[model samples]
Target: MTTSEHGAVPGLFTLVLHTHLPWLAHHGRWPVGEEWLYQSWSASYLPLVRVLRALAAENRTHLLTLGITPVVAAQLDDPYCLQGMHHWLANWQLRALEAATTRTASGPSPASAPEALRRFGSREHAEAERELVEFDAYWRHGASPVLRELIDGEVIELLGGPLAHPFQPLLHPRLREFALREGLADAGARFAHTPRGIWAPECAYAPGMETDYAAAGVGHFMVDGPSLHGDTALGRPVADSDVIAFGRDLQVSYRVWSPKSGYPGHPAYRDFHTYDHATGLKPARVTGRQVPSADKAPYDPDRADAAIDGHVADFVDTVRKRMRAESERIGRPAHVVAAFDTELFGHWWYEGPEWLARVLRALPAAGVRVGTLSDAVRGGYLGGRVDLPPSSWGSGKDWQVWAGERVADLVQLNNEVVDTALTTVDKALARAAAVGAPTPRNPVADQILRETLLTVSSDWPFMISKDSAADYARYRAHLHAHATREIAAAAAAGRQEQARRLAEGWNRADGLFGALDARRLPVA
Candidate 1:
């Protein structure tokens, strides 16, 4: 085992943040589409990166492992998205100004015009100005440059994943392999740094995926704690494969946020659902669980700031205790990995970014070793080997959220589209080979594969099962599936001109990955 300067303190701590969203650009915008991207970019990505840059300036390296899925990275680098995000930020500032004017002209009492609205307006206006400066200075070129700076400086380890976030366990073998390789290639092209590890979509895995990962040059991946039978203090090699699987420590992770209870539920934090009808801003605090949103108290930044300190301390203590206890039990320096969606910071929980910053800074002072997942493996924190079953970080710790009875129809639709697309592409390739011609680099077939991959995204089924934006999720799935069918039909009928027109239309609408090639599919 490798030794640190502290000479075997309590244990190691690794934070993994998975960043992802479906191909939302050029789709819809309001209610659920590109708006999701802009909001997250403004609230989460910008502020979080600023925090990291601050920490890096202080010479703190290897702060966390960041997974930016290929599809989301595509959107971040898209010309259309950058322009739309700038416009969105400018509009946010205008809206804040309008809210301030409205409040000043007609001064209402505390009951009518809560203090939270005014405070929120001022805060948003200031933030918009600050973010606009950052965007013009750093992000106007796209997120790749910003991300590359961090990776190059050793401030963060980048984890990548498949082209679209497909549920790998259910995907056909050939398509799954193609997606994984292409996704890594896309990331390499964007960052100029091929990731040695990846955040498997949904942390979903089936037996024998290790061989594929190994072939793709992935050294490690993340899985849920239960997948390792609840002993998650150390990484474990998957059934004799050198590829390591790190289990997320739910104990330390759940301290920040969980389904039932967490720090975000504190009374002082901003309420996520309740919004001011006029200003479209969250103006109420989560005063009480049963309290109606209207009756909730106005959000006080001071109170929330105090809550953030408390939560940070609580999280640090929890990590320390878990690591110490696990180290003693295992008779070695153990590691605890706490993973979460990167958007949770500043997007869902307003105080999350502050909490994260404080926690990272405090952990090292509290004698906790802060490192990335790669550090854990290199430092010999991997445990014994075992065969991992099909698992996901979902409800019931299985594939219920994506492939359960509730989403059976979507599951069937996804399978049919995938099968049809694959067969059509394979037949086209064979026709070219049989005629003693060069293999066809068919753009139509490539677009069909792209549509098929988008249709199988885990988001649709998860949203439908959870009853959150079920209609939008269904619309996206069916829309992509229909596109795949149309393109495949045109190709099958030998209508080259029609196929080219249809493909170009779809390409303009749903295009993200320009490097995607249909020739990657295995021979039929």
Candidate 2:
């Protein structure tokens, strides 16, 4: 209902990058949050940071629309995580060394194994090492300091969300309000910006969640285009909230993760599966042949460079065409926002950075304006009134992926734990509010709030669903359950001392979200 900066707005093309992972520093080693963090750091964060810096150096604006969940942000700042990530980076170099030596030994034409190993220790290699060290330092020293710089620099438009990535639709509706309000308050304090929008976990949307969003002071929210059911695109006000629903532009998003296909599956890219047991690298043909690691072709920068050009050009053409047609059909300027997880670039697809930089630059050259989601809402665009459906931007745009039979128990348990935690916190806060005018700040209430958010994290069930490290997932759920239990015991027994000690322990361990106070809930 309110457009804060309507005059200077450009037609919207939101490039949202959802960034998250479960608590992973002390978890198991592979296939879930820990590995996911390492893989994404190397493949996505490092390179994406490179791309952002490059674009900034050239003064290219509207560079990114990024989402960082609180739990993931917490890990990125943890000292333990910094050490683990550094070791992983060093080990990756060793892996390259092992792969090169084994491949050369089996080659028909001798490869330069010494040359490859030398490259690992060379100046270029040292430079890469230095870059990661600096990047990691930025995150560890205080992610908010660096992240705030990016936001204030106008290089990006930051998006905020619940403390943990929760599927709001299925969450107890009362807690949805609790989560949303606390998330924004925390992010605003850290980043020094009151975000006008939210990237709902999995882009999940339910019909009445808008009230919670409105209560939280979010202006615009996102959902997959299909989730609109039959609604309009620009965005629409939800009841009395003044919060608007901005649907994803499926025309553009489907290029990366669709029902049947995506460019990442192209044979030219490094295969995600079927890594060599001998060399610990993916060196075989992904589709047809049982090509051995030794026989597979080496990665040629030239081939990937050429592919990037073609893909970028194709994307630009596609976007330009879509914008023209959609504008004509709607009889207004169509805002096409294409969103994706930040990890997909460079992490899932090695050549993703090149593709992204090219696409971002190409959009403007082709007369298709690119922007962040908030930019669109600020531009005064409006949608026909309609309610969104219960949907997520998962494999099926439904909850099936996270709530299927395979992971039903985990999902069901998560809902129960989250609901219980919220209920306990609500009661505790109500008592706190009644007894005293309020302390300078309520750290106890904040700790309880922290426990509540950690328990509600979507990552646990998601990790279980992927079937990667179910044990770690189970362990984490139990860990959060313990925290939630601590809150319940403290509230009931009036053992505020025990609650304080446990809260301090979590503070010593994971202190990011432990700074919230329920008394600061926007004056209720």
Candidate 3:
């Protein structure tokens, strides 16, 4: 680890925010669809980008490692998504306005109106207005230009993952390699830099996956601490490869968000689940975890600000103490990494972005060194070789969540879909070669692979296991699975016209990554 320049703490801290969501374009828009995308975009992505740009103005570099999965990048840059996002932002402003005026102008008597509701309306309206302007100014084009600014400026290290965020451990080996390469290429095309590290979907991994990383020029990847057997003081070289595996430091990470407690549970923070039905705005504070929504108190920005300050200090102290102790016990400086879903900041925990900003500034002030994961590797934070077992950051820190008994059916469906897709594509290629008309981009085969990848995404199994919108998850998985089967079957027969028609129709609904080519699939 790098020594503190001011003789403060002698350890390193890396914060990784994995940004991803399943492709929701042209899908349903309520409970769990494009709504999910718009909420995260307005709440998390917009604010997070603003925070980074603010810090960048102060000349901060290596602030954090941000993993924007290839599938998400595709949607962010897609014309359809951009148009939809604009509509969402405008609608948000309208809702906020309605909340501010609906009760005062036409509801129950103004004297009987709850002051808390009025306060919420005013605050939300102001925020919505500001966000609308922000969206129009920077995000109207898409997330690419703004994200590219950060990537090119070196404000953060971008981590790229496979197309569609498939859980690699359960994937066929050839498909896994194909997805990784295509995902990296997608990132390269969007940001003009191919990421050297990836936040493996769910931090999922299997032994010997390092050879694939090495082949794709990926220098490092993240895994859960249990996968390292909890000795996570430093990055480790996996097996016999030069690729490094950094494990999340759960001891420190869980301090902010955990199974039992975290700062977001504080009473002053905005309650994520409680909503104002009329305006669809969350108007309550988390007065108590088990408290009923009716009894919850109105959110107070001042109180939440105090909570953020306290939590930031507590987190910095935790990191400092943990690092000092671990460094002593390990006979050297320790490197601590804290990874979380990017959506957690503003979407799940309303005050999370502020807490994050304060923590980033406070850690250095408290003498703890902060940098990206690349800095940790370059500063000699690597330990001896480790042979990892199959692991994920999911429940049990094992593969059970994605391949558990609960999702056995999905596992089987994924297998069948992938096999049919690969076989169909192989035969199509062979036939084309025999006809002396090799094609660079077979629309039918490409759509088959696209649907196949979407069908195998880890999100489906995760949602099914967690039961958080399991029905929607099931619908999406099977929807893509059916598409893959029909498209592949049509192509496998001599029904060229029918295959093209099916592919074209599917393209209108499920299409993302217009650059995806069937030829990119490995032939061996």
- Model with the higher TM-score, candidate 1 or 2: 1
Candidate order by lDDT, decreasing, is: 1, 3, 2
lDDT of 1 by residue, 1-524 (tens): 12343234576899999999888988898899999999999989998999999999999999999999999999999999999999999998887766555544222223126344666678778888999999999999899999999999999999999988999999998999999999999999999999999999999999999999999999999999999998998898898699999999999889887899999899999888776666666667888888786576777889999999898878877887898899999999899999999999988998888888998898887778999999998899988997998999999989999999999999899889999999999987778779896776888888999999999998999999999989999999999999999999999999978988999999998887889989888665
TM-score of each: 0.96, 0.84, 0.96
Query: What is the alpha-carbon RMSD of candidate 1 to the true structure?
Result: 2.7
Q: Output the better candidate (1/2) by lDDT.
A: 1
Write candidate 3's Cα lDDT for 1-524 as tens digits.
22254347878999999999999989899999999998998899998998899888988878899999988888888888888988888787787777666544322223113566667677887888888888889887888889999988989999999999999989999999999999999999888899999999999999889999999999999998999999999999999999999999999999989999988999999989877776778877898888887677778899999999989878887888889988998999999999899999999998998888878777777788889999999999989999999899999999999999999999999999999999999998787777876565688988999999999999999999999899999999999999999988888888989999999999899889778888878986
The 10-residue segment of model 2 with minimum total lDDT is: 1-10
Please list all clashing residue pairs in model 3, or write none if there are none. none
Clashing pairs for predicted structure model 2, backbone only: 43-346, 43-347, 235-383
lDDT of each: 0.89, 0.68, 0.89
After superposition, which runs of candidate 1 have C-alpha atoms over 4 Å from their true positions? 1-8, 104-116, 434-437
Q: Is candidate 2 or candidate 3 better by TM-score?
A: 3
Cα-based RMSD of the predictions, in order?
2.7, 5.4, 2.6
